[model samples]
Target: MREIELSLNQTQKIRLKRALEKLESLSSKANSNSNASVSISDSIPVNLEDGVLKGHGTLDLNGELVATVCGVVERVNKLVYVRALRARYKPEVGDIVVGRVSEVAQKRWRLDIHYSQDAVLMLSSMNLPDGIQRRRTALDELNMRSIFEENDVICAEVRGIQHDGLHLQARSQKYGKLERGQLLTVPPYLVRRRKQHFHHLEQYGVDLILGCNGFIWVGEHVEVKDDMVEDQVSKPEQQKSNKNSISLEEQEQTYTPIETRQNICRIANAVRVLSILGFNINIEVIMDTMNLSSSLNLDIHEMLGSEFCVLVAEGEAERRSLTKRKG
Candidate 1:
């Protein structure tokens, strides 16, 4: 368990301690049958006759498989490995990830996806704004910064690892330059891979993207418009105004509503509390936490206080217990 440093009174401390203990108890009971936490040098049992294959975080010493790191033991058919709770993000093909542009290379943008190495986003891999399906010319290479520049946050898919390095692609409009949002990072282990990572909270008018690399993006929702339609509508207007002149529509687009901004902060604080408590982070859990705070009429900043944290922990424990019973 992670220790939360807060200016908590004696009563708050006792409640928090009790809540955390309950959470720990529930988690241990649920995972007891399927998983086992091990420390370095802990001997892992294996059927020697089956000829076990040792994977990462495990070492074969004197015909015994022992853990090389402190983590939970995972078995995949014949392969046995340890999954470290705290580690760098490992990329997988087709996985949606959010990253920041580290360098704008000649034809590719290097992104830091919290991986062992920086991921590459090539100019040729992504769809251009014009929605054209043509070859990337030298002009495209020269105007690469027009698409993405240094330190710009982008969402892309893990294309695959090439000879150069891990490559990312933004073939869809949903998979590019994030704006007007807070980026919160938690341990990758807390964010499990799921079928759908993109969520549009219509009620709050917010977008939540649970990036596979443990990058949580909470921003105002931007409707995905057809590129051809947008181009057709804007071309005539573009001809009327100077290219450098900013339009009123563009200015309004840049301005986020105060209500939406508050919702973003409130949702973001829920994530922070969940991460601090080491709970599994997902869209449902995040929304539930937000609802809990709202029902109590707690302010956004108050969500991070010791009392709210304790309440969240207790609620989580109760939820998990009910889920286990139903199962």
Candidate 2:
């Protein structure tokens, strides 16, 4: 089993292993009777008479169906595929993802989203920062850096996979550059696809983006402003007033609040602890872990301690046991 690197004593290690074993038992019961996991080049047991269709991670070998990767097998009707846990993200249409700009190419931006290849965000696919919709002229192409420069982290959607490559789009206000946050990377399998990925924690004043590509973003909440109306209002004001006369005091006022910053750290640490534990990550589980920390009066740093890790593991085991009973 894969385990995170931690400084664990003998007792803590034993406890953690016991919890992990219990979790495995729970998961094994929920899965099919026949082992769904397979190794590379393993021949899958499929009825050829029923007409088996090979999907991703599987290849036809003479007459037998063989897996091309080591992963769990999933069968949907007659179509069979392997869901590889350690493989690069395989994007589907409309998957919300978070990525960092690797390069600003001619008319497209290359983003590193931990895929087999970098994803492309064409100039035409995104809305202008000022919320203007028009033809993308050479001038717009030249001013691309003004919108998203190199190394800027952006949230976008998987438009589709073309013959050329994977494509992404950010056409709405919600899909844009992220700021004042920490980006956490984990195995893509931990984050299950769901209807809603963008979450605003009103109590904590933080924004969480559970990207389908395993890039998790936790940041201060940013209000979605009506950029079109603001653009219209500011255009006339720009024509009448000087634009470059901002004072240092006004710039300093844009700083994030100390409390909000603390909240951001707390939430981010909670995610990091969960990832280190190799647990399934969701809003409910994350918030529950946070509540656990608070209930025990564990400081933000103490959450990463050996005792806390063991406690979290034991807690997760109990939670899964309860879920199994409910099921």
Over 1-327, each residue of candidate 2 has an lDDT whose tens digit, in order, gives 467589998988899899999988877777657557788999988977788888999998898999999888998988999888777677999999999999999999999998989999999999886577999999889888777778988899999999989999988777888888888898887888998888888888788889999999988877776554211100110111233576778757757788888778778788888888878789998898888888999888888888887888899899989987896
TM match of model 2 to true structure:
0.88
Question: Taking the tens digit of each residue's C-alpha lDDT, what string does model 1 give over 1-327?
Answer: 777877789988888788778777876776678878888999988875797888999998898899999888999999999998776788788898888899999889999887888999999988776677899999878878777888878888999998999988887766778778898988887888898888889899888888899888898877765553221111111121244587889878769999999999999999999999888899899999999999999999999998898889889878877898898
Q: Candidate 2's error at 93, in angstroms?
A: 1.4
Q: Which of the numbered candidates is closest to the native, going by highest lDDT?
A: 1
User: Model 1, poorest ten-residue lDDT window?
Assistant: 231-240
Candidate 1, pairs of clashing residues: none
The global C-alpha lDDT for each of the candidates, from Candidate 1 onward, is: 0.84, 0.83
Query: Candidate 1 lDDT (Cα, whole model)?
Result: 0.84
- What's each prediction's TM-score? 0.90, 0.88
Candidate 1 off by > 4 Å: 226-243
